[model samples]
Target: MVVQKSPQRAVLWGCGPQGSEVTVYVLGPTTQKKQTSVSNETGMWRVMLDPIEAGGPYNITAASTNPTNESVTLVDVLFGDVWLCSGQSNMYFQVSQIFNASKELALASKYPHVRIFMADLVQSETELPDLANVSIPWSVPNEKDLAPFSAVCWLFGRYLYQILKYPIGLVESCWGGSAVEAWSSPTALKKCGLDYMDEKLMGPHANSILWNSMIHPLLNMTIQGAIWYQGEANTNYHKDLYNCSFPAMIDDWRTAFHEGSGGQSAIDFPFGFVQLSTDIKNSTDDGFSDIRWHQTADFGFVPNFRMKKTFMAVAMDLPDSTSPFGTIHPRDKQDVAYRLTLGAQVVAYNHILTCNGPFPFLILPDKMYVYIIFDQELAVTPSKDIFEICCSASVSLCGPRSNWVSAPIKLWVQRTIQLSTELCPQSEEVAAVRYAWRDWPCDFKACPVYSAKTALPAPPFIINFQSSSGWKRRHIATDNYLSTEDDWQKMQNGFL
Candidate 1:
C-alpha cells in the first residue's frame, strides 16, 4: 500500500479478528520504531504509527496480536514533500491537450520519484473523502498514466524533484468549471463573513460544497504546498468580494492543514497560485481589475500566520494571439509552469534572488503628473499603451472611454514612469494612476510595460493620490539599492 511520506503523518490501517490486538513496526535507514493498538468490539484493529523523518525508503510491518498469522508488509516506504494541485478546468487541463504533449509525455517517464493520486469529482454536505470513493491509486509518471494528468502540476513537480532530489507526491483535487468558493471551506466563509453567497454561490457543485468532499479528506495529510489556477468563475461576478474572500480562504486552508497535523499553534505552509489571464470576454472592465488587484495585494496584506509566504505566478503573457480576446486556455503552459517554478524558487525554496519584472515601489504625486517608481531589475521599455490615469479611484469617473491617455517615455533605466498632465488631461488633481489597467481596446502585443532585466511581467497596480499623504523614500532599486517589497500597507488598506 502507498503512504504519504513525512514531516509529520501517522499511518493507520484496520485489521480483522473481532476484539483482537495488533502490533505495527517501521524500519527506516537510520531508525526502527513500533506502536500497539487493540481492536474494538468490531472485528477491526488499528494502529497509529509515529511520524518518520524526511527522506525515506522505509519498511513497515503490521501483524495481529492474536497468533493466527494475519500480517501485512509494505516496502520502499518514503518520506517526501507532497503538493496538492487544485483549481478549475485550467489547473485540471490535461497533458494530452497541450501542444507539446508528445514531448512532455515522453519526458515524464524520467521522473520516477514523482507520484500522483488522481481524484474524481465528489461533493458532500458533510461527509469527507471516504476510502470507498477513492478512484485512483498512487502511481509514478508513465506513458499510460501521464496522458490524463495535470500538465501544470506534473511539470512543477518534475522541476521541483530535479532541484530537491527527493520523492514528490501530488494529489490532483479539482473540478472543471468550479468556482473559487467551491474549494473554500465552510469555516472559512463563517470566519471571513463572505457576503452575497446566496443560492447562486452554493448549488451542490459550486461554492464550499467541494471543500467537504474534495478538500476535507486531505486535511491531515502533510504537503509541501499548494498551487492554484482558478478565478475564471468568480472574477467576473463576485469581483469586489474576492479581495477579502480569497485571502481568508487561503488562511483557512493553512489553518486546516496545520491543525490536522496536530500542530498546537499553526504551521504556515507556502500557497502559490496563478493569476487570471486576459481574454476577449474579460475586457470592458467586468471586474477583472478588482480581481487582478486583489490577487496582487493578497501576498502583502495576508500575513502568513506563521513563516509561510504567499505568492502568485502572473499569467497575463500566456494568452494566445489568435484567441487574444475569448481564449481561456493558452498552449504556452510550459512557460506558466516555469513562472510558477520561479515563484517557488524565491518564496518557497529561497534559491534565487531576482525579479523577472519590477514590483511597484511607490507613487509620488507631483504637481502635473505622478511619478510611478518600480523596484527590482527594471529597465524601462518603450511602453506605448501601458499607462492610464483616472480622476479618482471611482469606476463612475473612469467610464469605458474615460480620461484615458498615454504617456510614451524614452528608453531609460528600470526605475520610474512619469504620468504627465498629457496623460491625466481630464483631472488636474489626479486621483488614481493605473498601469495596464484595461483588458482590451488596444493591441495585446504592445500593452506590457514592466520589461525588466529578467523580463517578468509586473503586476497591475493603482497608486491613489492622497492629498495628506506623500511618498516616503524606500531604497532605490538598482545594483547598489535593491528593494522589491513595496509599501503596500496603504494599498492593502483600501487606499487604492
Candidate 2:
C-alpha cells in the first residue's frame, strides 16, 4: 500500500483521494496468520517477505483507491548485469560479415541466459521517456536470430558469455553513421561547453537525448560494462572534438544511468572502446592515422583507461589484401572480433599482459640504469643470455660469463640496470647499447616463428650501428632518443 499525508491506511484499491490513507494486503500461501504489516517508507509500502514467504510463485496485489493512482504491477523480471554497447558502422556491422558467423550463432542458440536488448535508433532533443522497449527478452543465437545483430557486438557478447557463463544482457543502441554528439544529452554537451547542435537546431537538445530516453531507463538493471567502437563519424570530417567529446559521452551515460536508477552506487563500471581501425582514411581531414593516434593518446587522457580495455587492433598488418581502398567498410570483420576478444581477455579475465613487440622503448644509460618496458608481462627473466646491454660491437656477451653486460632484470619487474660504463676495457671505446632489438630472425624460444625481427634503425642524428635489419649507419647528433610513451604522446598531440 502507498499513501501520503495520512495517518491511517488499508489494503484497498479504491482509496478516496490524494491525501487519504491507503494500505495494501495480500495473503501469502504460507501466511497462516490473518494479517501482518512489516514496514513502511516515506508513505510508501512493500510486502515484507518472512523467511517462508521469500521463495514464491504467489499472487501479489496492492489495493489503493485514488484517482492519482498508487502503483502499478511489474511483470516477470530477473535481476542481473546489463551492458550497453553503442557505436557507428563498425559496431552496427553484423555477424554475417564474418565467415560462418552463422555457425557461431547456432552454437549460441542453445543458451537462454544471454539476453540482448536492442533500443531502436531514434534521435531526440528533449528529455527521454521513462521506459524503453523491453518486449524483447534474451534470445538464443541462431542463423535467423543473429540476422540483425551487430557483428562486433555479437562476437564480443559471445566471448563475454563464454567466459562469464552468467545471465549476460546486451543493450545495443547504434546507428551506422551517427556521430558521438547524437548520443549525448543536450545538457551534457552544454556542461562540456559545446553549443547545442541538435538536428533541428531549435534549442539546447543537441546531446544524445534519445539514448538517454531509450537506454538510460535500464540502468540499475545491472550490467557488466560497455564496448565502444566508434569515432568514424566524428572523425569523418577531422573534428578534434573527441579530445573532449568522446570521454564526455561515456561520463554522461554513466551520470544519466546512475541518476535515473536512483543513484545506485555499488557498480564500478568499466568501459572498453575500440580504437578506430586501419581501413580509415589518411586524408589531411579525418585521417585514420590521425584519429588512431588520437585514440591511442586517449588511453593516457582518461584515468585508468587502459589499452587493454580500449584495443587498437592493427588492421594495417592483416593479410586480407583484397580490400576496397577509401571505402569505410571492411569486409573481414571476423579478425576484428577476434582481436577485440583478445583485448577483452585481458580486461575481463585478468590475463597476463605481454609485449606485442619491443614497446615503450629501451634506453641505454651512461652508467647502469637502462630503462625498458614490454607491452605485456615478460615471459622470460631478463638474463644476460636473453638481454645484453652491449657497449663495444666487437665483444659478445653470454650468460654470466660475459665480462661486459650487467645482469638482466627479473620477471614481473621493471627497472634500470647499472653497468660499468668505463668504456669497453677490451678495445675501441664502446659505442651503443643493444636491446633484444634486431631485424630478420629473432629466435627467442617463446617468440612466435612468424615474428619478424623489428629493429630500430640508426637515425641520421643518432649513433650508428651495423645490423642486417636494413639499419643504416648515421652520425649521433644527440644522445637522447624519444621513448615509446613520449613518441606516442607527441603523435597524440599532432606534434609528429
Candidate 3:
C-alpha cells in the first residue's frame, strides 16, 4: 500500500466496475491533499499524488466504484527510502538465528522508525500485481517482528536509519532453496534466448514463477535500490551462464522497477550483492569463486552512468571456522551486515570510503614471479603462511582445487604480493596464482589475509599469466571455480 513519495508519484492501484470511475485523495503531512480520478477504466486504476518530503506520516484515502460504497484509508504513512532485499535463503537468514540474537533483538527496540514489508513466499507463471493473492502488512520493528526479520537487511536499514536520519523501508523478498534464474524476469530470459522458466530450473513452480509471484507485484512501487545475497544455489549449476545472465538480470530488474514503476526519469539504481563465502563441503564445483568473479564484473563492466551498478561484499573471509567449510549458513551475520553497510556507504550514499580489502591485480614478470597489485594499494598484515597457491601447465589440467599448496608470500611493496615462479618446477610455465583461496581452517583463527591499513576483509581473487592465446589458468582456485577458461583471461586483462 506504500508508494514512494515524490511529485506526481503513483499512489495506489485499484479495480472497480468496468467502465466505472474511481477516486483517490492523498493527504500530505501539512494537511495538503491532492485529488485524482480515473474515468472509464477497464477496472484498473493508477492514482498519482504530489511529492512530500523524505520523512512523512501521511494519510491516503482510496475509493472504489462499487455500489457498496466502501473505502480504505492508510494512516501514519511516511515517505522514505525504500530498499528491496531479495535473493535466496542467505538473504532470508533471520535475526533470531544470528550471533548474540538476544542482544540484537533488544537493540531492535531502538529503531522503531524502520519498517518492513515482507513478501510471503509465492510462485506463479504469470506476472502478478502487488498483493495480487498474498497480503503481507508493513510493520515497524518490534520485539515480535524483529526476531524473524532478515538479519542482514535489518542491520543495513538500522545503520542507514541512524546515519541518514530517514525512515528506511526494508522489503524482505526471498525464498530458501531458490536459484538466481528463478528470480529473473521472464522477459529478460527470453531476450537472451534463455528460459528463466525452464522446468528443470523451476523445480516445482512454473518458470519465472517466483518473479511473477514475488517481484512483479512490487515493480510499480519505487525503491532506493536493491541488495542481493544469492548464488550458493547457483554456485554449481548456473555458474557458467551467470556471467552473462547475471548482468542481464540486473538490467531487466532496473527496467522493470523504474520504467514499470512509472518513475519520472530513468534511474539505474544501485544493486549491491554479497560474494559467496567459503562453503567447501557442499559445493562440488568451484562455483563460489566463479560466481564471485561475475559479481565483481558489474564494477568493471557497468559504466558510471549506471550509478554504481554493483557493490560486492566479500564474504570469503568471514566464515565460521568451527562450522568450517562444511556449514553453508555461517552464523556471522554481524560481519556480513557491516561489510554490506560499507558497500552501501560507498555506492548508495556516495561516500568516499575504502569498502574492500586489498583486491588483487596481477602483473606477470618474464623472470621469476607474478606480482599481484591492488586497487587501494596495500601493506602486508603481520601474518604468515596466508598465501596458499597452486600452479599447472594448462587451465584445465591444473583445474580448480587441483594442486594447491602453501607458497612463500613476498611482500615487495605496499601495493603488491609476489609469488615466485620457482613454486612451479624448473622451466615449467606457471599458469596462475591464487591467495587465501581455499576454505578457512577448521581452527578459530581469523582469515590471515587483509588490507594492511584499512584491514577490510580481502576478497578472494585469481591472477593468471596473460599469454598470446589467452590467460593461462593453472592454479587451482577451488572446487566450484569451474568457470569458463576465459574467466581467468577476463580477470587479468579485463578487470586488471
Instruction: Rank the models by TM-score, top first.
Output: 3, 1, 2
- Best-fitting candidate, measured by lDDT? 3
Clashing pairs in 3: 197-207, 285-479, 285-480, 286-479, 286-480, 286-481, 287-480, 378-414
What overall lDDT goes with each candidate model?
Answer: 0.64, 0.45, 0.66
Task: Name the better of 1 and 3 by TM-score.
Answer: 3
Q: Residue by residue across 390-441, what tens digits does model 2's lDDT show?
A: 4554424321123334325432342223334443454533344433221111
What is the Cα-based TM-score of model 3?
Answer: 0.84
Write down the RMSD of all candidates, one decimal each. Answer: 6.1, 13.8, 6.4
- lDDT-wise, the better of 2 and 3 is 3
Error of 2 at 423 (Å): 29
- Per-model TM values vs. the true structure: 0.82, 0.56, 0.84
lDDT of 1 by residue, 410-482 (tens): 3334465655645554444455566666554234323455455666777665554444334322222221222
Ranking, lDDT, top scorer first: 3, 1, 2
Candidate 3 whole-model C-alpha lDDT, 0 to 1? 0.66
Each prediction's total of clashing residue pairs, residues at least 3 apart in sequence or on different chains, is 8, 33, 8
Poorly placed runs, candidate 2 (over 4 Å): 1-79, 131-138, 198-206, 265-268, 280-286, 296-327, 342-358, 361-496
